[model samples]
Every structure is written in C-alpha cells, then in structure tokens.
Target: MFSLLSSTFGISRPLILKPQTWRIFSSTHVNHALPMDPERRKKLDERNERRRFRIAHDPEYQAKQDEDKKQRRLRYASDPQYREKLLEFGHIWNTRKSQDPEYVEACNASIRARQRSFDKLRVRLQAENPRYRLRKSLHQWCLKHDWVRETLPWKTHQPVLFASKVHKECKGCTRVKVREGVKLWWRKIGDRDESWLCHACHMPMDNHTAAMPYGYEDVTTMEGIINRKQELERTAKG
Candidate 1:
C-alpha cells in the first residue's frame, strides 16, 4: 500500500513531508513577485515631474523661442506683401495637398517662370540704355576710388564743358567757340610769345608757334578731352 501511494505522488513526496520546503519556495519567489514600495515610487514620480517642469521653464529655451519670434517679425516686416502671399499659399497647399498637389506645384511653377521673364525683360531694358552704362561705369569708378585714396583719387565733379554750350576757347583772344564737335587750338599765352598749338588746329596754322607735348597729338579726340577732365578732377580731389 505504501509503494502504491509513493508511486502515485512520487515527485511531490519530499515537499509534502518537509515543512521547511514551503519557506524555501516562498523565499525564492518573493523577490520576483513583490511590488515596489509606495514611497520610492512616489519620490521617482516627483523627480520626473520636477525634471519636466524645469525643462519647460528653462530661460535658454525661452530665449530660443524669443529669437525665433524676432526673426519672423523682421522677415515679415521687411517683406509684408511677400510674407502674406507665401502664408496664403502655404495654407492653401496644406489644405489641398491630399486633393491637388500637382495643381499647386504647377501654379507655383508658372508664377515663378513669369516672374523670371519679367526680371529678364527689366535687365535687358537697363542694358540697352547707354545712360545706364554710363551710370554703372561712374559707380564702378567711384568704388575703385574708395579703395586706395593715397594712390587713387575720386572724381566727383562734372566737367564745365558738359554743362556749357562751348567746349573750346582761344586762350590768346579769350574768344569762345561753340562747335558741334571737339576743336583744337594754338594759343600765345603771354607777351613773351610762348605758343602751343594742338594737333587739330595746327594742321591749318602753318606758322603755329610750337609743336605740342609728345602725347598731345593724340589728345585731339573726344575721349581725350573726357579723360583729361577726369584726370583734372581726380588731381583736384587728391
């Protein structure tokens, strides 16, 4: 009868016979099954809450937000019309993306292409105007003058000849002449009979007093007069 009972509960016989077996089993499983202490859990929750509060209230985060706001304000202030249009387009795009992304992209592309065409036309018009070229040349000249003042001088003044109708005058007789184009001349400066004749007028005057300075032969051109005036203005400024 004992053998039959032992066979029926073979593996669990020692556990039922020994009272200390329950204590050993309980000790091994207690650590795995027990819940965390309430106070420690509460302290951890408080710490996490404090961390989140600190992050939300940090001055650096606030400063970053303020800087972003300021940049947005400046951008909008500088280009209110563009900003308004962009914002309106953004809203439309967001609202319609699911329904009409392709249409929105096509509309934006067409507007950009039209704007580029208008810009190109404006550039071409400015380029065709000679006055615009002159102004640009004058501006570049001024910029170069600003770089090296000791060696290079700025020419800010317009020539009196440009304003006056007459560009040529006889130094000897004080006779002014208004000609359609540039005129050269030889003039006797004083009673000593010191005379200098420009190449253009010297061709007609056989008795022209003296041959001009070496490069003066080439100085009879319109470009020469402009260059001479520019040089004089630069010298005066320096």
Candidate 2:
C-alpha cells in the first residue's frame, strides 16, 4: 500500500502516510495543483527572454517585424472571411484559456519578466552606446524645437527637407550662406543642441577650434565607433 501510494503521486511513502503532509499537499493549494519543473522552466524562460530582447532592441529584426505586421494588418482589414475566421479562432482560444488560472498566472509572469528584461537591456544600452544616446538626444531636441509633430501621422520632415530647415542661418554666427552649417557634434556639448552652428566654430576642418580637445572624426562607422568609445572611456578616467 505504501509503495502504491508513493508511486501514484511520486511522493515519499513516509510523507504520504503523514496527516500534516497530506494537508500541505492538498488539491486546494494552487501550487500543488500544477508545478513547473525548475530546470525546464528556467530554460524556457531564458529562451523567451532572448527572443523578447532581440525583438525589442534589434533594428533589422524590428524592420522585418514591422513589415510583417503591416502586411498582416492589411490582410486582416481587406479579407472579411479570413478576418472572421481569425476573430472566431482568437475568441474561442481566449475564452478557453481565460478559464485557466494557471495559464493566466503564467502569462502575467512572462509579461512581467519580459518587461523587466527590456528595461534592464535598455538601461545597459543607454549606458554603453554613445550612438544610441546621441540619437535619443536628437529626438528630444527635435521635439523641443517643434521640428516634428506630437501625434501619429507625424509631421517629421524627410532628410532633405529636415536638412534644409535645420541648416538655415547659423545660430552662432548668423551666416546662412557664407558659412557652412554644421549639425550636432557627437563629441561636443555645444554642437549637440538642435540649433545649427558654423563649421568653423562648432566643427572645424582641422579640429583645432573644437571645444573638446579631441580631433573631429566620424564616429558613426563601426570601427570609428569602437575607437571613439575607447577614447571617451579614457577621457572619463582623467
């Protein structure tokens, strides 16, 4: 009888015999009803974390994903029969799964984990990548300058149009044509603002006039980026 009971629930024979153990293992307990294997669950969580991280951070992956979603949305909007079928399937699946408290708990846990992972990754990237920080600054500057719209169907200008508007009379020298306008310098604080400045003052051809002691260089390229990152790190130490 002991062996039979032990084999039935995979618990030790002694535990099965104990009244206290039985109470602890009662069906009323949510955890006792369904328990995930620790090792398997960890592997699944790691896999999901990696997938979510890539989707949230990778630009190439995001572009492909955006295109796929755009196509799916177009199809869903155009094909009534297909859309209906999808709606029916989604409704049924949601209705069935909504009744499962375990499934709901698992989904909530996964969402929370994904969000935590995303936040950490974003913070790390912001700390490590100068390019990302530069872009974010530009985005904020654009918003501040009213160069872009607030809501969807944004009035953001194309590169050429944006350049035209951004390149007008230098904020420093007030010379629009006689002097070449320079955009934000990745390395200099004065040049990083939204307003344009004359190249002579903000971005010198020889880098002698640059506020920062370092010479002006394009850090946008991969090799240049690594070199620039090291330079910044070295500068920070001093």
Candidate 3:
C-alpha cells in the first residue's frame, strides 16, 4: 500500500513510514525544480556591474562603445521614420539650447567668422584674376552710362522697358548700349551676307552717338527712314 501511494504521488524515494522524511524530500525537490538559483542571480549581477565599470574606466572600451553607437545612429538615420524622429529630437534640443544667451552669441560669432573668411577668399581671388577686374570695370561702365536702367517706351506710358531684357553685355565695346529696345544690330557683310553685332559696339560704326528709339518722329516707316538718312547726310555735308 505504501509503494502504491508513493508511485501515485510521484515520490522519487523508497517507501518511508515517517511523515517528517516525506516532508523533507518534497521540499528539497521543489527547491531543485525552481527556474533560477540565488547563486546564479548574484553571479549575473556582478558581471553586469563589471561591464559598466569597464565601459566607464577603460579608454579602449569607451571608444568601442562610441563606434558602436555611431554605427547604430547611422543605421537608424537611413530609415525614413527614424530619420524624422531624429530630426524632431534635434530641433527640440536646439530650441532648448537657443534660450541661452551665451549659446546665441557663440553661434553669431561663428557666423561672423565664416563671413570674414569668405570675404577674404573673394578678395584674394579677385586680386589673382585680371578677368574679374575687367568684368567689374565693364559693369561699372554699364551702370554709369545708364545702359542697365529702366526706360520709358517712345510715346507710350506702358510698362517700363527693362534694359537687361533688351540688351546683352557687349564684349567689343568699353560700354554696353541699347538700340530701339532691340537686342541685335546687324551690319552688311556683302551684298548677300550680314553679320550681327551688339548695339553698343555698332553705334560708332553707324556714325551715331546714341541709339534711336522706335516710333521716333517719321522714322517708323521705310520712306521716313530713307528721308531721315538723306537729311542727316545733307546736314553732315553742310
């Protein structure tokens, strides 16, 4: 009967008649069946503390940790969702830091330094390149001659003519010029050929000091132009 009872209760020991022995065996079996032991838990805690201490005290370990962190950040940044989260976090961090006057002044100082560096570089480049000086002189001449300013259309109060739209930079002349608000000035190369020139450079060749605007007194028609040219020739001869 005792053997039958032990088998039924799943007791590992041989039949013992004492109740105290049965209790001791059952308690010991329960302790052994537990998932974690006290000694194992203590050993795990110690290992984790040592790792933390090494990460703090050892330069090599700290560098490894930083590299690992950088790699993780790069990986996360490649993900669009994580990138948005990182941007939001950075904006919030910067916004909080911007409240400090020292931080604001430091940022302004750095910006001023960068601006000064850029200015020095530009001056150095301009001094090194003769073409830059020539271009600057040409630009100044254009401005001085009023070649790059707005003009009213002949006999009309419509929208002002923008010089940049009507004329281009004339490389042949010391100054740019406009003609009848037109961009091209063509000269006869032969009986059947013509060559295009900018109005500014063409003015001297055509014996004109200034460009004639469109709709100027009877110069609008072919006959008017011929008569005007004849009158100018007669005046020049006289």
- Best-to-worst ranking by TM-score: 3, 2, 1
In model 1, the runs with Cα more than 4 Å from the true position are 1-94, 97-99, 146-238
lDDT of 2 by residue, 1-238 (tens): 2223222332211211323223322211122112245664455446556756887899898787678777877886799986766545444444554467875676567558778999999899877865554455434433344322221112112111234423455444656452443343222233344443343334333432222223323333334534665677788798
Model 3 RMSD to the real structure? Answer: 29.5
| Candidates sorted on lDDT, descending | 2, 3, 1
Scored against the true structure, residue 117 in model 2 reaches a CA lDDT of 95
TM-score of each: 0.25, 0.28, 0.31
State the C-alpha lDDT per candidate: 0.40, 0.44, 0.43
Clashing pairs in model 1? none
lDDT of 3 by residue, 1-238 (tens): 3233222332222122233233322311221111134575455446546766888899998798778767756776588776555445444444454465664555466558778999999999987764444334433433443432233122211112234545433335534234333433323233253334453343343423223333333332335544665676687699
Most accurate candidate by lDDT: 2
Error of 1 at 175 (Å): 45
lDDT of 1 by residue, 1-238 (tens): 2222222222111222223222211111111101134464455456546645765799785576568767766775698785666445434433443245564454456558778999999999988965454444433332343322222222221111122233445333333232332333334434365443322333323422122222323343335535765776787799
- Model 1 TM-score (2 dp): 0.25
